[model samples]
Target: MYAFEYKRPASLAEAAQLLSGDDEAKLVAGGQTFIPTLKQRLAQPSTVIDLGAIGELAGIREEAGGVTIGAMTRHGQVASNDVVRRVIPSLAGMAEVIGDPQVRNLGTLGGSIANNDPAADYPGALLALQATIRTNKREIAADDFLTGMFDTALEADEIIKEVHFKKPDVGHYEKFRNPASRYAIVGAYVTRYGGTVRVAITGAGACAHRWSAAESALGGNFAADAVAGLTVDAGDLNSDIHASADYRAHLVKVMTQRAVKACA
Candidate 1:
């Protein structure tokens, strides 16, 4: 890694101040992705502000008919948290399958959502469950927070403080994971809240996105047949050596069907 100044701020206000002053500063949460990029010389920030020291950015609590998780809360914590398991079992199940134990132990919800990796699992859950991202500066809805693949609405000086997810009446996630990295080849998160049904698809497109057509069909009939009847357009999907765009679309439908079963 290139030589850099490291700042570990105790508070979010101090962290923002430290970041705003440094023209080339990057925030490091879990450092699962950024650290590798640093070693590869893909990034050369003048300063690295570690959010780990901020005590307010770590924990899980219930509020306002939903669950709020501090940004620094690790994937392992989310997977194991009793409140998460009780309130959003499907979301907890999704967290349990991310990477291996080491990555889970280090990786965090805020980091995953901020990075917005196209293949990441948390994006699928966030989008499907109607999550809200809280930053030091402002709060962004999940739809607005994740702008694109490896992109988000976060400003350079902004630090994500926590994430709020509404407890769905029923929800489930299914993924076709890459054997080596455990990244999603095609992941689907399906949710139903009262009469509303939502389907979020990831790993098949440039970013995780909601499927309105499937949601519409499922809103009326929440069944595998509802997903089966709808045709997925391959035009907007990602295609690569591992799987073609058309194949990914097929996987999306199949996984959505599986997710429905899991939700039921």
Candidate 2:
């Protein structure tokens, strides 16, 4: 990796200022993605703004209406949080399956969401849970936050501070992952709240996308059999060495059904 100036900011404001000052500066929360990019020479940033010293960017807050997870909160924390498990078990389950112990201990929710990897677990849960991405500039709905593969709606220098997830009536996540990498080959999250239903799929397309047909069918009837007749085309799905686009499409339905069963 090329030499780069590193700045450890003690506060969110300072981190934001440093990021705003240098266009080529990258934010380093957990460094799982950034470190790899640096090692591969895929990114040559002039500066690296480390947010580890920013205490404001860590922790989990449970409220009556919902829960707010600080951006820099690590996956291990989320996976084991008793409060998170009680309130949003699906999210806990998703977090628990995020990588091996070392990666989970180091990977932060903010980093994962910011990277916007197509196979990342957080995006599907975010979309299905109707979560909100709270950034330094504004709060964006999960549906609007993700753009495409490795892309988001965040502007330059914008840093995510927290994510808010609504309390659903019931929800569950099921992922068929690439065993070696632990990245999703195909994943599904199904959430039911009041009379509404949402089904989100990841690791299958350009990005995590909601299954409108499944949602519509399942919304009308929250049952595993509700989605049996529905199908998604493999035309735009991802095809990697781990799994074909068609295979990923098949997994999407299977995972969705499993998620529904788990939710039930």
Candidate 3:
């Protein structure tokens, strides 16, 4: 890694001030992706502001008719937290399967969503559950927060505070992941709240997005057969060596079906 000044602020306000004052500073939460990028010389910042020491940014709480997860909360914590499991077990399950033990231990929810990796798991769940992303500045809807690959709507110095997720009446997540990294090649999160059904798909496109067609169909009939004829367009999906765009589109449908089945 290139030489850089490291600062671990004890509070959110301090971190925000530090970030706003430096034009060439970067934030590090769990360092799962940032550390590797630094090692490969893909990113060389003048200062690396570590968010780990900020105690207020990590925890799980029951509130607002659902659950609120602090930004710096680790994946393993989310996976094993009793409140998360009780309020949104499918979310906990999704957290449980992200990467391997090392990645799970080191990756933070804020960092993952901020990085906005297309294959990341949280986006799908957030979109499907219609979660809210609360930052130091303001609150952003999950749909508005995730823009594209490796992108978000956060400002230059904005810091995510917590994510508030509505407890769905029924929810499930299904994914076809890369065996090595365990990153989803195509993943689907299905959720139903009263009569409204939402389906979110990840890894197949530039970013996680709601499958409106599938959602509409499933809303009418919450079952696997509901989406039997639904087709995901392949033209805009990611086609890497791991899988073709067409294959990923196919997996979207399959995973959505499987998720719906599990919810049933």
Candidate 4:
């Protein structure tokens, strides 16, 4: 990696200040994804601000209606937290299947959502459960947070503080993971809350997006058939050597069915 100034901020306010002042700066959380990119010369930030030293950005708190997870909470921590497991089992299940033991242990929730990789798993859960992203500057709804592949609404200076997810009565996340990296080839998160049903799909599109047609069909009747009947347009889906757009669309349907069945 190229030489860069490293700042270990003790508070979110300090981190934001450092980030705002450095035009060619980047946030380093778990370094699970960014480190590799830096080594490969794909990203060349002149300054790296590490958020690991910030004590306020790591924990799981159970609230009355849901749970709030600090952005720096590790994937392993989320997968194992009793409070998270009880409140959002599907989220825990999704965390359990992301990457391998090493990656899970090292990856942070903020890092995952901020990276917004096209094939990442967390975005689906965040969208389906109607999670809110709290940053140093402002709170953003999940839909508004994710803008595109490897993108987010976060400004260069903004830092994610935590994420709030509404507790669903029942929900499940299912994914057909890429064999090598364990990234989702196609993943679906299904959630049901007081007659409302939400279904979010990732890994197939340029960014994680809700399957509105399927959500509407299944909102009234929560069933595999309700989602299976609707067709997902493959016009903008990711297509590569591992899986074609058509195949990814098929997996989306299959995985959504599986997720709904699991929710049942």
For all predicted structures, in order, the TM-scores are: 0.98, 0.98, 0.99, 0.98
RMSD of each: 0.8, 0.8, 0.6, 0.8
List model 2 lDDT by residue over 192-262, tens digit each: 99879999999999989999999989988999999999888999999978998899888989999999999
lDDT of each: 0.92, 0.92, 0.94, 0.92
State the TM-score for model 2.
0.98
Q: Count backbone clashes in candidate 2.
A: 0
Please provide, for model 4 over 165-253, each residue's C-alpha lDDT reduced to its tens digit, 9 standing for 90 to 100: 99999999999988998899999999999788898999999989998888888888899988766887888899998999999989989
Quote model 1's TM-score: 0.98
Give the 10-residue window scoring lowest on summed lDDT in candidate 2.
59-68
Worst 10 residues of 1 by lDDT: 140-149
Which candidate ranks first by lDDT, i.e. highest?
3
List where candidate 4 sits over 4 angstroms from the true fold: none
Q: With candidate 4 superimposed using the best TM-score fit, by how many Å does residue 216's alpha carbon deviate from the native? A: 0.7
Candidate 1 local Cα displacement, residue 225, angstroms: 0.4
Off by over 4 Å in 2: none
lDDT rank, highest first?
3, 1, 2, 4
Candidate 3, 114: how far from true, in Å?
0.2
Q: How far is candidate 1 from the true structure (C-alpha RMSD, Å)?
A: 0.8
